[model samples]
Target: MDIEQLIALIDGFKQFPQIKRETTLFDIGSRGHFENPMTEVLSFFCNTTEVHGMNDLVISSIVSLIRQNAIYESLQYAQAHGKPQREVTTKNNKRIDLLLNSDEWVIAIESKVNHQQINPFDEYEAYVDSLIRTKKAVNKDNDLTDETEKQAVFVILSPDGKVDNVHLHPRWCGISFQQLVNEIKKRLQQHFFDAPFNKWYLVLKDFLLHLENLVNDEEQNSAQEEFVLTHLGEISQAWNLLKNTLQSVQQKAHTKLEQHPELNGILRSQKSSWFGLPTTILYSKDEMTEAVLFATGVPSVDIADDDPRNAGKHIFIQIHIQTDDEELELESIHESLANKAVNHWYSGGSKCFRWPVNELSIEGITKEFVSTFEAINNLSPLSLNK
Candidate 1:
């Protein structure tokens, strides 16, 4: 009924971890040959010449899914517009992932996973221009005059269902992996029981389930989610209490760490603003019992020891004691953090690397905070020397 109670229940369930064995083609292949499962699957679905007998079905299902999600007027406009083209060529020399083409209507899809930097709108706009140009060349009397009306639909397809360019482009829509799975299931249900698609249907189902898991970051039959969904009515009874308590606890822990006296003094003296916890905190061994800690900010951006102009030692270093279980905590720290810090710091960054804390107590966190101050004090006032 309470927030603590819900969290306790969730924590208890986590003990029985979901076993994610290599199941899907992409998952198993990813271990040996391929690196990205998302790319592999997308390519497979897009390639009609592949051994899979259902590329057309997959593409159509995706289009229908997007149409269902788009605005009612947009949907009506799209349906009334021209026939679907599998992958149309654009002026910018990029193939539109999926395209529907007619004299006055065009739909385009761009698929991605984990990638965020690309802005495909410019390329898409170029493609639309090419389409218009081609139409004019083919038919001299082409009556496609309504440029002001919605003529093109751009859909961004991703596992996470994120659409960053929708605000910039009014015609842009987003379709998530879950929505794709639901559409596939709906299409499958429409076929008769004794249909010839039984084998293909099973294959599609397996792949869809894999995509669903990939998006949600959970096993197909996630026990925790299943439990929560089934007991939503009961859980909703104390939802506010659970939500508020969890927020309060998290806020208190963060505030305590941020406002530690020693940390504040060290930050002010060094002319460095606190930038949250470092992914990895390394320490140099002091002759004293505690280790000298230093939060090596991301190595790529931060200046290292070898820099010729190491003036105004804005270096972030701290002193911290060992946690209750040093070995366990050490094992839990991300390997990349240690690797990057060592790589950036060169040689001296090695030796006494320790994770800051495990317990949420103020005493432990403050000790961790104070470790940085100790590290700063050891360095020469203007440079990182000794």
Candidate 2:
């Protein structure tokens, strides 16, 4: 839709937070937790609109707007990009998504969604020394070449003459939507229309090797094998199908990331700035009222402050949690969720918060969460090196 329409849509949420007053002002028991009804409503409406086919993008946007950091990490380490080395995390059974390294480039990805296996141990580690180098020798600004250690932000754009110079790496050689498109375009120009017609042959060949491992795995079932075989075509076709799906997901995340521009956009106004923070909300009962009237789902929020029901601002936000596979929202699912939110608290225009609804986080770049980039950068395995 056009930008004005988009702005109007957001403004609609602002209006929703004030549709009704609470029946019991002084004590409505626990007003429950806080809920972010805007996205739920957007999600509900999106599922039913002419944009049905683009639902993933809309849903991802909703989730990404609420979960930027998680999206950033996912973009870096998704399996399609490279091999990943697993890490140790006490918070939960979190796993590193992917790891990619050449003599010149080393990347470690930490994904919050689609966390398949928690511990992808070393033989599980592809190319041991390479994994170590990708994880340990990344960019660190104050680095000295005395040891091979490098900084995390090092990119592959420029390479030092010395092959073993671990101190030298790409500075932000991270891929973006356009870069990916260019890469695919380059491959297509040279070989897509050629005899093999396997533009992804070189890249997907490796995945095919991995797929072979999958077939051989004792855990594999007949149904799974059949599914793989049925979808199998030229290696390039398979890769594209998967990449297209991911691209679709990635694009949707970008869209979702764009939703809360006023708040999330502020953290990342620059190219190199980092944006990272716990997705939050700040508003009054009127704001909450505005949110519910215009948004969808039973907005799930945590009550930050429970003061007098009649004379206090009720700030609300959606909770984010890192996990594998967010719940899918078919049109029906969104429709039901939207209806449910209305039926729950906002029935007579009363606003409320519910704890722990869907905890999803996106790893991204935005104005509000710009600080996150530095946080992740500091935590980056690349910067960890001396």
Candidate 3:
């Protein structure tokens, strides 16, 4: 269908529909106390760190309903600490609404609602440029010989028409609210076409008959209202069908991903024959810190030489929890132990010597962390097989 017809269909749902400038998004589904939803959606779209805001909720509700997606969150060892790198942010604001990160493969959505106006192309351009720069940088690091960009899906959540993919970049493509319902309609048509045409037509007719009952009640049947509500009723039916199809596909895809033979490797890796068993419990901060120390303690010792004779060797992980919250630190636990030790050491003398401790510089932490973890794995009884 033409863009105008799609825009008109969308306009029927909410205010701020068609604009002199097509970039203006309709404000339908606008009113609501949707802080949680927006925060969740913003975080989902950005795909890295957590985000929360009322505006984020508004954007998220629309994006989630129209686009079959959400932001992806991940946690990993970075610089010997759990540093949350927000994966994407849009550059449509004076201060970027999204941060595209070092690579364009991920997008980090950041927004400040205080701005008078947001530049339409700011996010689009930043996303493209981030991709280019990321490839070049990665290539530069890997030697100019391997400098090729990776492809990723491009998405825009707005009322505007899709950007000229050719004019912009090959990886860029988008859909608007106006286009979403039509896409669903097209899928219904495809399903009908694929079935025996007669059967499909009859099935579709039955579906519409059910829809007619929904809109045309025995009492309120004005001609104009019927004409309007009839389409709405059909849309509701189509939505239910689409939802089921999507859910089935999702279940199938997830099954493949989880049951794939390769996942066996990851499973084996995660649940290792270490000191005893896997330690993957969800714990509160205090409980988790205690658990990590307890878990780490469970790892049997390799070097037994502890007396003042040989090299007093000790292997321990530095619990580097890089928190933006200044209130928390690893030292509190250590210091508290030391304070308790003051009374015990006085009572017990040299029997319980303080533990040898060291801090790692953040600069070399990433390389060191990966290397140390690999070493820890090597020390693992599980690795003795290899």
Candidate 4:
């Protein structure tokens, strides 16, 4: 597709309503590192003695979603033998994420976040097999009259109900986080007011919100995949064109930086760490300080207010000053450019300054870079060492 066609497609895409996911405590705490924390939370709620006060409700709802109906019935109707265990050791010392046991049933759960289902399923199955055999032996020794045989259920829980290596184990069953979330919601509706003042309820709510966010994110990604598949030809053409345009813009920016008279000796170009765009770097005399400028085609609304891109501004620039220089007063330099800068902060033992650019052209970017460079040099003539 042509540039105009690509622009029209982007414009049309932007017209769709934005659905913001609500931020939860789990979201903040996990920050995409969710596997262990999620397992702990699930184990807590699944335990009857936990403060969640919902007892077997959560675990029962989870079991109901499993493929084995007998196991769910046993766990839901009968009392679990003990508290749910986290990171339970298997026969080969492999740790299963969660383990729940009853007199007649043994359930082993392997939890996955973003990683593939590439665990020791054989070990897990063997562990469950050992447990079942031990249970049967004990029942026989005690001469228990109950005729029902012991059962083992192996579950692979992930964001999507998929097991990458299901062939490794015959008992492994797949369950989605979304399915568990839905089941828990259905069960919790009845117990919403059971403990009106319980803090664990709030914790459960937060955990559920986190799970919902993960499930929603997966669903949105699926929708995006569908969209890409539906418009593969147009999307491919547009992407190629966009990449070509960006390369052209980068070349122009580099030429402008090299051609600028004031930046004669100080100018160098490198790839930006932020967006991988071609960056124009102006080195100070000591070579410790650097003034970095780059142009991004990122849409305004996608940029954060405090971002180096200056949020809604079309141009992006940054100044880096080494902290080891005793003569360089970072605050003084920060203050001098405060009026022209969009934002300034300290990071990685270096002071950073961002200046606004209203124009979208290469010349506009070059002008801002030169202006900020001069401002810093004026503040501490010795800092840039230029």
TM-score of each: 0.42, 0.19, 0.21, 0.71
> For model 4, how does the per-residue alpha-carbon lDDT over 180-267 read when each residue is reduced to its tens digit?
8888888888886665657887788888888778877877777777777877888878766645544555565455544545665345
Top-TM-score structure, candidate number: 4
On residues 223-280, what C-alpha lDDT tens digit does candidate 2 reach at each position? 4456456535433353444344333433433344334334343322111101221133
Q: Please provide, for model 1 over 120-237, each residue's C-alpha lDDT reduced to its tens digit, 9 standing for 90 to 100.
A: 6777876675555554321232234454443556778776676776567666678887888887777666554435554655656677777766665533345577877876766676
Q: What is the lDDT of residue 24 in candidate 3?
A: 11
Candidate 3, 1-386: lDDT as tens digits: 44565456556544422222211111225521122232233334333232311112222332333234322122111111111123333444332333232221333232222122234454555554565555443222222212133323344433333434435443434444344334434444655455544443343333233223322332233443654685675555544553443334333323332343433423221212223322221112232221111122222343233323212322222222223444433334443233221111211111222222233222222223222222222222122111
Local distance difference test, per candidate? 0.48, 0.28, 0.32, 0.66
Question: Candidate 1: how large is its RMSD?
Answer: 15.0
In terms of lDDT, the poorest run of 10 residues in model 4 is 138-147
* Ranking of candidates on lDDT, top first: 4, 1, 3, 2
Model 3, runs deviating above 4 Å: 1-42, 45-104, 107-128, 131-148, 152-154, 159-172, 178-386
Show where candidate 2 strays beyond 4 Å: 1-94, 110-174, 193-195, 198-386
By TM-score, the better pick of 1 and 3 is: 1
Clashing pairs in 4: 285-384, 285-385, 285-386
Where does candidate 3 have its weakest 10-residue lDDT segment?
75-84
Query: Candidate 2, after superposition: displacement of residue 285 in Å?
Result: 45
Better lDDT candidate (2, 4): 4
